[model samples]
Target: MESADETNTKLNGKSPSPVRSTRPKRSVRLTVKPKCFRCDKCKCEFSDQTNLDYHVSIHATDKPFHCETCQLLFSKRASLKAHVRTHSAAASAAKKKVFKCDNCGSKFTTSSHLKRHTRTHTGEKPFVCDVCGSKFTQNSHLKSHARKHTTDKLFACKNCPSKFSRGSDLKAHVRSHVVEKTLKCDSCDAKFSKKSHLVRHKRKHSGERPFHCDQCAAAFPENYMLKRHMRRHSGEKLFHCDICGSKFLEKLYLKRHMYTHSTEKPFHCDTCGSNFSQKIYLKSHMLVHNGEKRYQCEMCDSKFLRRQHLTIHIRKHTGERPHQCTICLSKFLTSSNLKTHLRTHTGEKPYHCDTCGSNFSENSTLKDHMRTHTGEKPFWCSICGSSFIKNSNLKSHMRKHTGEKPFHCNICASDFSQSSSLKKHMQTHLNKYQPL
Candidate 1:
């Protein structure tokens, strides 16, 4: 008879993924000190099979049990019993390190998560929805995929009429209805709702072009941007002009160009009675009417309606301002005015501000800002051309220009552009004596 210590052996075979090594393998041993039921060293206590059947099933190297969802193979029947919990939704409720991926930092308690993430690198799609020809790398993707085929919107917003396919989608959409834009950029003051959209915004600040087109040297930050840019080179005009019959790649370009063809101005200013065909033109016009840009410059304390416009305004504070004066060795404040001043030296822009008889750095800003003294808005709104000491002040008065801050300073009643300003203001108590 072999001693228990001498007979103690380690199985020498490849284990699947080595995750099983953390848990010692347990199997029914044939050797017995107690009397055997039918024969010696033969029967399993749990099963009735005593001879070849019991010996082949439990003591075998072959993995007879396997999972249908995730491609995980198991050797023992009892080990396969615990594997089924991974596919269950309830299993996701309590998360432990059930599985981890080596390629990416993402970790999940279920083996399925690691499997799904591996698909991102391999581009594998095991799950496919039958209703639509949509394929997904994971079963959970198939669930979200099926929702697109059906009119059954399970996720409905309590506050709004909006409906969505998934519960998480509805939860994100609800955040937009609030009076706040809490999503601040790490690089800048810009805020956005969706993280994907914020990522797109980040690329704008960083000037990152991740999406590349093989057809051309052109690249964009997003897939849709690349798709749109590719159309320009390919001349793939999907959006056709009704009047001229000329086609454009994008709907927005066609819409903006439609203004030349159509006399109908859809976008109208409530204050000035000015009308516009394009929605963006309407938004710009509405901004003109409202005279407001909520985004203020952190450097020199200037405000802009659009975040990009404010970004351009920010270049003013830094000496890196590209807009330079063409006259004798002079550099000026902002890009807009630099072009106008360049005209005086370069004599580039022949257009002059008539009231002051001053040649402008920019024909537009000078033209707009000049209305201050004349109190004359020749481009008066059909609604009302309100008076301001400056046209910029008139723009500031535009009722639509509301900042994120609803409250103002109690002492001066001065309005701040953002809520962060108020928070910083309140903190001034601790550092009141501190020098700048």
Candidate 2:
């Protein structure tokens, strides 16, 4: 079985193209926080004493609040109260339950939480956005949605001046600056911010995949990962784009697709000023400018910007072609390459030119075909300065420089750069062999 990481990585196959621009440079210096109280456990520093005390609690093995029956430790009394409720049903009933529903027997800790839950059974959308026709169960959700309509981003990051509409989003952004790896795995010394993250990371080593999909036999380490995989089987796309009315299984894909309708590329590379629709794409593009090929093949010294590319390149060394064409049984290194090869058997010409109704099997072929209509010869020979529509034509033209003949004639010691000239030369030998 393939790992959860491999499955998740393969799902995001669509790569965004970087927009090359030499615009005016803008320098945004990253905010550096002063290290005051440093923890002896992880050596992480905190800005305040209160924050330092909170950080120390994560590493603390002994807790003051302990259950008499289970002997399970909890730092907070409220957490102990919640944990005790899981074991004893009678103890849960004795607790101060503020929110009780009349429709259902469900009880909540707070009234706000119960109000949110009540909406599910009542089918009531009390909170509606004024800007959009979108309705929400809670007022908080409506307020979060309303931020998109207005330029009111109250939560600003101290690490950088980056602002977010939601406080939760701001907290997540702040984590990048303050939080390093707080929790460490016992199997491996690999660290994580949260204990839950450490638990997920340890799964990779222990091979403990507890979460199983009901639709398929696929298993994952995390429940959220299992949920993500189920979307493929269920065909349930919750996220919808307002602009195109197109639905996506994931919100990240929907955001990436939104770029197609817009002319703006907000995420720019500091090194090259190359713009990208997504921040992740910009980070990947920056590797090109920095010459940072971190993912290297073990067999060969060949390096790649992305781990996916490295994985594909490693297959070349192993001769392991996992992606196979269903029709022809031909195997390929990558799924994209397999998809292209499958088209040969399927006779699927999806790409079409608008100018001329000519269809092409590949998008690249259609792009090259457009050059004929526009008379655009982008590929130019460095030797002769002669231009051609295709790079292959320009490559053949380059042989005039050093007179490199790749194709040779058997009859005579004649060589040609162009394969057509070699074929025409072969005809002479064929004529000579023919009896009159």
- Pairing residues by index, what is the TM-score of model 1? 0.26
Task: Write model 2 residue lDDT over 1-436, tens digit each, in one string.
Answer: 9887667667987444568888988999998778798876445678888889877775554567876444456776766898778657634543766677776555656787667666665657788888778876578768778888887676666568788776678767877786778788887778876555565677789998876664458888776687688666434455666654456778888988776544357997777555677887787787787767888888878989889989988888889999988887889998879877977987877666777788777666876787898898878777668999998888888888878999988778898988999999898889997999
Residue pairs of candidate 2 with colliding backbone atoms? none
Judging by TM-score against the true structure, name the best candidate: 2
Q: lDDT tens string, model 1, 66-123?
A: 7554334567676677776745643344346556567655455567656655666565
What do the candidate models score in CA lDDT, each in turn?
0.60, 0.73
lDDT of residue 182 for candidate 2: 70
- lDDT, candidate 1, equals 0.60
TM-scores of all predicted structures: 0.26, 0.41
Give the residue spans of candidate 2 off by over 4 A: 1-225, 232-283, 297-301, 374-376, 380-384, 408-415, 429-436
